[model samples]
Target: MPRSIDRHELWFGSKLNPRRNSLNLIRLVLALAVLVHHCWPLMGLGGGPEFAGEWLGGWAVAGFFSISGYLITGSRLNNRLGDYLVHRVARIMPAFLTCLLFMVVVIAPLGYLAAKGTLSGYLSTTTTPLNYLFSNMFLKMQYADISGGPYGVPYPGAWNGSLWSLYYEFVCYLIIAALGLFALIRKSPWPITIAFVASVLVQANIEKVSVFLGQNYDFVLLMRLLPFFLGGSVLFLWRHRVGLHWIPGILAILSSLIIMSAFPGWGGPACGALVAYALLWISSWLPSPEFVHRNDISYGVYIYAFPVQQLLAVYGLHHFGLAAYMTLSAGITIGLALASWFFVEQPIMKRVRKGKSDSGAPRNESKSSLPEETNGIEKQGSITATTQVN
Candidate 1:
């Protein structure tokens, strides 16, 4: 007598274990894509590079949010609010604060003095202190002020333009935590699902909302990015039922592209959902080598990239050529990012984890736990697909 295996079981069993996937590399690539996209504008090319202009950077950032959505939703589901906050802080703050300080004390001071030709003038600019305080707080306290840099730089006033996304990322985290806490109390996904649908719809209609409200810059950006974040959450909530097959994944992406081309703003949510599905599909079905998991420098890379680009612009490297500027900036950026991982971020995170263990707090499942559907089929030791989204 032969036993019949559940079709879903066979399907997932044939796929790579989620825990062992190369999400770190995926994030790193996305981050680099953003850096490369910026090269077009930063290099004085007169306009955005074909294919890498506004479209690529925004898409990469959206992809980052999608990954964050899935992993952060998983984080909220499996851990206590306090523990989750602790983990999020450990992942984000140390590297972020360090980068912010570098921008304030080193980059800003140097750029200001170089451009303005007087320390007193640089010191008198209130924007300097404001940038430090507000930007470090994720812009909740103050808006970023980019007051100094070489005049020739493409974006002289903006120190770390890439940082704006961090504020949104933090907001998304809060949103997920709020919904997750409510779901815990209610023991239902309906509320969260409804919120997700509403958010997506709002995003789809963002252009109309912008026009009706006279196009507030912050409002428009938030609406544009929110759909992808919500899509990620939806994928997490419905992970068990979502088709992981490549055929469906491909079709969804193509369909979204067609709809987006046809309907632009109205198709926003559909595009976001398809993007999230494609990202998750790649992460789940394709595993990376064990060695690739050892170091996660994506956060460092992301935080450090803009400063490097700005520095390049100050030095007139942008006049050289796009390839030369990108290569030089990326090289230095990667070096700093690796150093941040090895010296700053990794050590702080390790200490934070140890402190939590020493305090004897009830531990959540490892951040990498497999989804509910795969439980018991694989060894309990297998890692979950969710990686560090930040």
Candidate 2:
């Protein structure tokens, strides 16, 4: 007979060691999955790999949100409001803005030259590079094309389709920040639990809700995405009670698959908790390389991959066959991702950390450090933590 597992041994909270976890590796894989998924459509090969009626990119993005929800919630509970907001912005914005500028100055010119055979009118076009940059500076993509170039691409005009999700991700960050204002979120999981359940219900009945609320994409996307994020938040809040055992993890994955098989449309929302739990469980034991543990390039991969693929398509590189195209795109994207991480993301984050240290903040009060208190309770003056994950 199999030995019975001890309750304390199975607890996810006890097993969660930030320094040793494979979350960064998992996130990078998911980012690469998104790149692969987009490869199909950008190459005019039809929709990418699908499971449970959703594309691989969609599932990968869901995974991103789930992980973010867990880590970001922990961040909020462990920091002052100002510090939380600063970290969130710093984590997301710098490289994002740089990507937009790079697209305009470098990618757009190359695309315009390929399409128009000249760069004379590129700067003076209706959808100018300046317009693209300014419009999407806030993470909301208003203009997807620059100088009306990228004409020959399979998925023409759109510079970066992957960026749409960033707006929603930031919104989720703000939501956590708002919720953290109340001590209840730090004390009990009920607030996020109820929110998660409510989001699921809204998604299940989204058509009717859209009828009542007047057909908004923002609302629909939030309803679709929030539950997964909240599911992660719920897991973090109740980590002590939740087990990270393989048996339970396998069960959750199977349950999600069954639900998806049965209900194609709303199955994802219904399986949010299962997905979150399975992801966390997998992260708990998955082995990660030292490089990934030290440098997280997942965000860079995600933010840069779509545009890289689009540029390839713009140059008619998709005609080179899927394998060749994917190989080239992955190479370029990974290179850019590394630059973004080491040059942009990591440096900026380091400055943020340095600023905090220079301000005389206590060492234990860093971004990811948990307080001495445990089990969802916050003690007085224990207002910071160490090493926040995005």
What lDDT does the true structure give each of the candidates?
0.66, 0.78
- As a whole number from 0 to 100, the lDDT of residue 124 in candidate 1 is 53
In model 1, the worst 10-residue window by lDDT is 369-378
Q: Which stretches of candidate 2 lie over 4 Å from their true place?
A: 1-14, 363-390
lDDT at residue 267 of model 1 (Cα atoms): 65
Cα lDDT tens digits for candidate 1, 1-390: 112334663454323344455566677889898888888776756445433123677778888887777678777776677877777777777788788777777777767666666667665575755555564665443445545443457776666778888777887887777776774523654565677677767776777767877988767777777778777777666665565566666787788677766766556455666777777656655555554455777778888898888877876777888888889989989988988888888777767667777899665434442211111112222223333222
For each candidate, what TM-score against the reference?
0.83, 0.91
Candidate 2 achieves a global lDDT of 0.78
The reply for model 1, stretches above 4 Å from the true place, is 1-19, 46-54, 116-120, 129-131, 134-136, 141-147, 184-187, 207-216, 287-291, 365-390
Q: Give the Cα error of residue 3 in candidate 2, in Å.
A: 22
The per-candidate count of clashes, in order, stands at: 5, 9
Residue lDDT tens for model 2, 1-390: 112334644543324455555677788999999999999999989997998889999999999888777777877887788888888898899999999998998888988888888899998896998988888999988888888867888888887889999999999989999999998888888989999889888888899999877898888888878888888888777765666667788999999999988987688877777887787667656777778866788888998998888888888888999999998999999999999988988888778778977898643332322111112222221212243533
